[model samples]
Target: MEFGLWEKYYIEILDDFGFSREGDEESAKLLDEILSTEGCLTLNDLGEIVGFSDKYIVFGAGPSIKEHISMLKENYDLKDYVLVAADGATTAMIEQKIVPDIVATDLDGNIDDILLANLRGANIVIHAHGDNIERIASLTSFFNNVLGTTQAQPIGTLYNFGGFTDGDRAIFLAVALGASEITLAGMDFGDIVTKYSRPNISNALEEADDFKKKKLRYAEKFTNWVAENENVEIINLKE
Candidate 1:
């Protein structure tokens, strides 16, 4: 998607969530300065990978990720599709012995699992936002095949494809990069939170706080819009 078009939705996201655009910009600058894009995967490279498959499967860090993965294992050849894990969902995929083709994270998930995926050749897309500046600074060095992105305004090596949370962003990326057909697995937008929701890889399932639910609502709504508006064929496994 073009930045000109994406900015309109981004403005609304800032207004609805009351997020600070300046803070996001600051984080973006820091990330851009630190990330060495030399010899790394470019947007073109990503396109080749995403477009390699007939379908793209984007997985969210919802509670049902394991079951959905199992269903895929039982009925289909995963090698035929490009698999994307959003943030903490990387843990679920890794646990299932499935290494995602790509991972979109904001340093807010299980860093351990994401790193493992990176080591296993998953292209890592790191997003810069206000809340994760410190986390980004501390952990940026641990990743390989890194690409930077910012929702506010992309600078230098960073680029913005669109969408809010990691899950929706992964879909946006798949569409923008090359995938024409997509599938969403374990993308439940309920009011439940679990160990798989965020960085707490050692915890149990729990109720989502109001703020987390609010964000999920945005992700769900935006994802639905993409399915309807974008030219790609998006099949929501939940439906």
Candidate 2:
């Protein structure tokens, strides 16, 4: 999709989900600065990566993720595809010792883990927003001079949470990365399972419901936009 049209839909989605346009604008500006300074490419860069992959998987730190991990390990070929990890899942990925091909996060939680991953030579995709622009910018030098040579490239993306606690930035990052058939795992937008140890477990169900409602609405709008612009297929990993 054209960046301009996608930006419009992004604004509309945020508005529908109770986000402020002013905040989004600020976030966009910060993202632009981060991308420009980091020498990152657009979704076009993702196209080059995607063209080489047969399939792609997006890993969310949802409760159900624990259950699917074993299956994913056995069924999927790790080398041929890209594994995109959301912010919260970085620690979990470490616990499970799953080396993600790429990591996306806003640095809200699990900073230690992110740092650890970078230290271990894992390619990290830092998430950025206006609120955290200064912090993200501060890390630019470290990521560029120190961590850049470790992985393929450190990336950053514009985040639009859609005002839903469950609307993970990882989803958009995966799409922007040009996944041909993006399968989501641990995207349970309902109750949190007892098996999961995330802090939001108590309110998982309520949060998931709210997130699902907003996600459904956004998907409908995003689907229409995609139909008119690009030929990308979006699928729920749980399904």
Candidate 3:
């Protein structure tokens, strides 16, 4: 996507959440710091992996994940498709001994689980954004095979395949890398919070406020946009 178009949408997203654009700048600086310390992989490397797996199953950290945990645990010949886990979903997949092929995260979820997945050889698509600067610093050192991403403008080596949240970003990444079919799992955009959500996030949700609801609204919007925009078939398993 063009940076101009991306900028327009990004600004709208910030407006929707009532956040400042300066936060993204702070996050990008932290990503620069991380690049100075650890070597980074380009989308080209990510593309090579996606080329082999034409089909994908994207897992999101939502209540439906717990509801369908049994089916996911069954395996059912999932090796044939690429497994993409969105942020916090890594922990749930790891606990099941199912390491995803790709983990699209912004380091806001479980940093330890993400680091562990990276150590285990999963391609980590580390997203840099305003809210995750400190978290990125804490976790970037532990990753070996890492790809850099940004929601803002792409600079130097960092690229933007396009999507706002990790869940939609996973779909966008797959679409960018040439997936013919993508299936969604655990991506419930509803009112209830998932049991596996980050403690801080869960606590916020306990209030039953619109904050969490609005975030899910953006997530749903981004994913829906990807489904409509991409040429591939995106099946929402939740439905």
Off by over 4 Å in 3: 73-75, 201-208
lDDT (0-100) at residue 1 of candidate 2? 39
- C-alpha displacement of 103 in model 1, angstroms? 0.5
Q: Which candidate should be chosen as best, given TM-score against the real structure?
A: 1
Residue 115 error for model 2, in Å? Answer: 2.5
What's the lDDT for residue 174 in model 3? Answer: 88
Runs in model 1 with CA error above 4 Å?
Answer: 37-39, 201-203
**Residue 72, candidate 1: alpha-carbon lDDT:** 90
For candidate 2, the per-residue lDDT at 174 reads: 51
Cα misplacement distance, residue 228 of candidate 1 (Å): 1.4
TM per prediction: 0.94, 0.66, 0.91
Candidate 1 on 186-218: residue-level lDDT in tens? 899888776877555356667788889988998
Which model, 2 or 3, shows the larger lDDT? 3
Lowest summed lDDT across 10 adjacent residues in model 3 is found at 199-208
Q: Give every collision pair in model 1.
A: none
* TM-score preference between candidates 1 and 3, better one: 1
Between the candidate structures 1 and 3, which one is better when assessed by lDDT? Answer: 1
Residue pairs with backbone atoms closer than 3 Å in model 3 (clashes): none
